[model samples]
Target chain A: MYRLSGGAILWQHHPGLPAATFLAMPAEPAPAARPVAAARRRRLRADRARQLADLLRHQILAGGVPGGVLPLEDVIAADYRASRNTVRQALDLLRGERIVERQPGVGTVVVCEKYPHGLDRLQGLAETLREHGRVTNEVRTVGPVSAPGPVAHRLGLPEHADVLCVERLRRLDGLPLSLDLSYLPMDIGGELLGCDLENTDVFRLLEQLTGGPLGHAEITLEAVNADAHSAAVLQAPRGAAVLMLERLTRLPDGRPVDLEFIRFRGDRITMSGVLHRSL
Target chain B: MYRLSGGAILWQHHPGLPAATFLAMPAEPAPAARPVAAARRRRLRADRARQLADLLRHQILAGGVPGGVLPLEDVIAADYRASRNTVRQALDLLRGERIVERQPGVGTVVVCEKYPHGLDRLQGLAETLREHGRVTNEVRTVGPVSAPGPVAHRLGLPEHADVLCVERLRRLDGLPLSLDLSYLPMDIGGELLGCDLENTDVFRLLEQLTGGPLGHAEITLEAVNADAHSAAVLQAPRGAAVLMLERLTRLPDGRPVDLEFIRFRGDRITMSGVLHRSL
Candidate 1:
């Protein structure tokens, strides 16, 4: 099974195998294949198409279909007990969402793909996705400045206390992924002024500077419209929604130290985690 | 501290106190308060304003300012050691993002508000947000039917196995919040047919019927443009982004049983959690 970072676990079809080899037998008893009256049938067909699209979406997300390739049209109609017209409409709806597309000879295929980002781990972007591709950081700004009110408070510093601010535009395989604004206490940040900010993860730098493993992070995730500056920096369309992640990382001794605001392109990243019930 | 579910912890100001009373003394040694020569100074001043805006944004998210109220313009200038003009420009930047607004006699106050939704719990909407307000489920569709491909796989059922599907439009207070689609294997969902789905959480019913607490859930979250159907049902703007949460829940014995696709009005809800690092 192939699990898309977006929480879709699609059935992965083996290369060289015909797509039809993986088709599952129809579960529901077949509905009458005959078409009904034109006017009423059109209305019912629209509704059925929607329902079929919804089902196909779940199937696609589940990875029940092979290797992102959808089964043949006749196969889907028979499996869902829907007429060919209804199946076509369903496929059309998926097309409108840009989730799937028709290829000249490849038939219907899933088009939307996202990289998985683990929320449960407190690793830097590069560390988490090291296997996927090379992650490069383009350092935009790095210098000492007084902590803003909120930044100071989270880092447990006095208001206006001097802190090191680092701004970076991170890319994955040459594609813009996120714009990260990070603040660190000057005392710790000062020692790393000469270190490689472009190639190394800050999490790794902090551990070396502090001489211990970081403890935990308090995270809040939300969707927000990208401002003009952020959109321009990330190359995302102006006003497009971006996933905003605000995190405060603390040392094992429980002192809050590093705070970061990372804005990720919503289309390219998916945050996934296994969460346990606390209460 | 007021923690916006989206992970902002703002300093709450007491009622009746003047906003300026909470201002902190300047942190940096006043950046040579003397204004520099024109052309260079104008460019410098613009940069300063952007910097100031960034700081204030952090402070607001961290809850440093009082009660979502900005300090008086002059007071802000004094605190950040900036000229009044730069402070005003910074405010204008925030206003552009619609995060804060000017109220004639009230000064600038935060305009964005979101309820907190915890990511580290296996509770229904009502259970998770019981303290905030009422959460009512508008049952849109419910019945037994053949499980879709993905639903069946997630539920450990055979292809097209009979299952129950429950669709609900959940609201907080009277505002539309989320549209939820839930799938359960027939044995468990069948028992919930006559239960009070509107007022009671499915988690509660599942616990009662299964005779145990749920184990955990695997969740994936991302932002997606709301389709026409979802946009209309949630009363959200057409094509506006929504937070999409997909979850697969299991029993204590690790049996996958319930699968859900929940789309939240991104503007109204925030998902927050504390994550531990586990390599």
Candidate 2:
């Protein structure tokens, strides 16, 4: 029995092939078939550079370059014994995929990747940071304020009720990257006011306060440009492109619990999204 | 009663409030929620560009750039009174969400986005081209032959079936940008040889010959460097990046139909994939 690649190709044997071969013994090479593993050893350096690129990409994704700093040219080319051009090509491939990006004057930066935002995930900002192998936070702004129209609309709050507006800047390896703004009802957040923002994440704080963890979440992806304020904090240029993610989380009983705004640098991210349908 | 953007925020309400206030309030003097749209000047500019960008993007997706050339920059910037930078930002936004690009030396080239090569939406190669805009095909080879493993699996034919393989180069506005190799069952496609490839899409021919049309398809996206032979035909450099799409098309009733191989210039085309809940 002939076997083919899963979900891609099928292989089936013909019972009448021998009989057919006897009748059609005189034919030229068939068209459109990929040549079976031919040998003509003029070139192809075993593609060691390509393999190294693969290794590096996997490492980056697996948090090998945990600090998000990657050497640009020297180490990779040296390790693979490939020309800088070849190494650069591999890096270019990654850059095209937005897996890594050059920071102009600085070295290449690894903008960590996250699971494609979805309802199935209700991870906290701290959990996402820890998953990427780095963590730091600075609460830029937090205060009790009268609910705004939109926020009040989402929270189903009386226009006069105060909501806690917590603006936290998240960092990786001491460098600020994302500006996360969260809104929590005063009822749920009243006890957490004295906590240090630089050292804590809201999700963990909420679980500690409520005695239960968060569950499903709904998130949306949008494209945005950084204004001067965001660019200065994120260390990117003003008007630098960004991917904006807005997420609202719910507990197991469908109670809305958290609302988060995640603004990711556009340069160094490669997010994977998958769709599987039920038959 | 209130409305939040269609995600998890719809249900949650601010405690102690029945409805949002200031729904009819005049624009506030200060920025409140969503810093991105906080400023009147910036928000107006951003919104105009976004709407215009969406308009142009639809045109591009509809294959309105048939000459494979258009003054994307001038038309956008002048018409919108947006700076070249702003217009470029809009283009880049579309570039990421859509598959189209501009090379330094080459004018803006329109690369028709290809359908996925997955098992669900196995569109015939020519039909995929037609969706891009007006197209013409020039057949290079058409005959029965052995099928590649990927093709074999997709067709669901016996591994040893004498597959009908058709190879053709396709063009838009006289510029050859893509080449295709399609495989079908030999008995089912003997009629394909009689049709004129230069004039019509092969799927239309298949519908006439086989009494049905393809329904759903699934596609996989990958990158491949064009070989010397492929580079010569596509007029692109060997080792230059090319977008490769491998697909399997199935009949409306779920029987396997056709498998396709498509190679496109990486710079000219971008790809769009969606991840959603399974139905």
Candidate 3:
């Protein structure tokens, strides 16, 4: 339990200590003890703010915050029985994490949103997020080009082989979601040039063209700073972090057909899955 | 083919164009065509730099760059038939991505590393990266605490129930790697108080204490900005993005045992997995 009164704090229980321990502090120090006392006060305020921030963060992540809008500073301070400065510091901390933003007239609002993406299923964005909204693709560019060394190697082609490069800007609910850059071997890609890429996903197109179900995919996921072009396309701030998914998909016959580099807005998507103990 | 000569460029092939379309340019325009021609020249240089950056990025990711050190600016310019200014711009782009950095005495060097973490296996840090380096844990805090609301719900306990909280700073090769905060039910955690937590993994200890093999875990992964405390503990730059992994582990009998929130330095870890096409 924590109690704050007259600008002084009493921490009854701390995680670092065992059960049943109390530490009491002086209520008000003398005025002559100014500099050292002020420093101690600042440190104590920081500690209290951190504790408040942790509790609020856990609540926000668990969707327990009512209405997704934080109460005013005075209300928070009164509820937590802390000073206004402490509440402000806690909000600042959450703001730095981008978990909350202070709107001009709307008070502090939760800005964190993470749509679930399953890692155990090799599904297209549209198929996986069917319940979310309509996923539309704006095919920015699509044509044949000479494959670079790494692309050719991944697709099991010789150096400088022709491959179709498809660049699309994907959106959900009219908001930018991902920028997908896909490379396909010319044999299958040549046929896709005439398909309706603006309406359908490449996974469905490949299956329709090959007349067989896609088998599996090998994927690597990481967070990388978005480059200028990707940032502009995804509507993210320059140098902001983006979730980069590099996937190589193979056909049922075990031929690698499509290699994709997808950059998703980090704040909008969360990848999830279940893992068993294999060992 | 892309050819540059006398400050004029000839782009014969482009990904957005058909198979073999030639784009020939006037080698040298008159001096009076200065303003418009200069703007076009700048745009052309920017395009060339982007193309070069893509090729170099692919090479670096594939580990095909000899010695992991880039060639000199002049050498790259000459080899690609691009101007020195274009090479410098491309290097600047790479530097912005943090893929390559310039040292005081050394030339540009690759700085990207993604240690593989398998999503298909339920393993500890030490078990996952046995070949990379020895993983050591600095047990910063370990004791009993009243469980927060969300944690109690996850563990099937009443709110504010007594639970064990363990905070650790993990390292790889003596470099700060991850900061993990774990919560366990008091039944199992009481025994952990007397164990050697600094030298062993909690997963191994739980199995030994329970006399049963662990079952599975549900995980959610996303990129989050590092808070002040996590940044200081993990030795990462303040507000830099880190990979936040929230995991809930269950016993073979379907009882949720441990819940953890692990923050891994985004640049130091990569999560990889193979997924089947499950409908």
What value of lDDT does candidate 1 attain over all alpha carbons? Answer: 0.72
Q: Candidate 3: where are CA atoms >4 Å away?
A: A1-62, A71-90, A103-106, B1-62, B71-90, B104-106
**A140-213, model 1: which lDDT tens digit per residue?**
55656666566777799987776676667899998899988788887787665667777889999898888888
Real interface contacts reproduced by model 3, as a fraction: 0.42
- Per-residue CA lDDT of candidate 3, range B1-279, in tens? 222222223222345754334211112222353455566655545555655675576577766778889989998765544568778988888887677999878899998755777777898887788888888877755656656566778888876676776767788888888877787887887788767777688998899999988999999887766767667768877656678788899999889889888888877787888888864
TM-score of chain B of each: 0.73, 0.55, 0.76
Top-scoring candidate (TM-score): 3
lDDT of each: 0.72, 0.52, 0.72
lDDT of 1 by residue, B82-169 (tens): 7798899888877865668999999999875677898877778998889989998877556566655556777999867766667777
Candidate 1 vs candidate 3: the TM-score winner is 3
> After superposition, which runs of candidate 2 have C-alpha atoms over 4 Å from their true positions?
A1-120, A131-134, A267-275, B1-279
TM-score attained by model 2: 0.41
lDDT for residue B198 in candidate 2, whole number 0-100: 69
Residue B101 displacement in candidate 1 (angstroms): 4.2
Please compute DockQ, using alpha carbons, for every candidate against the native two-chain complex: 0.24, 0.05, 0.30
In Å, residue B96's CA in model 1 sits off its true spot by 6.0
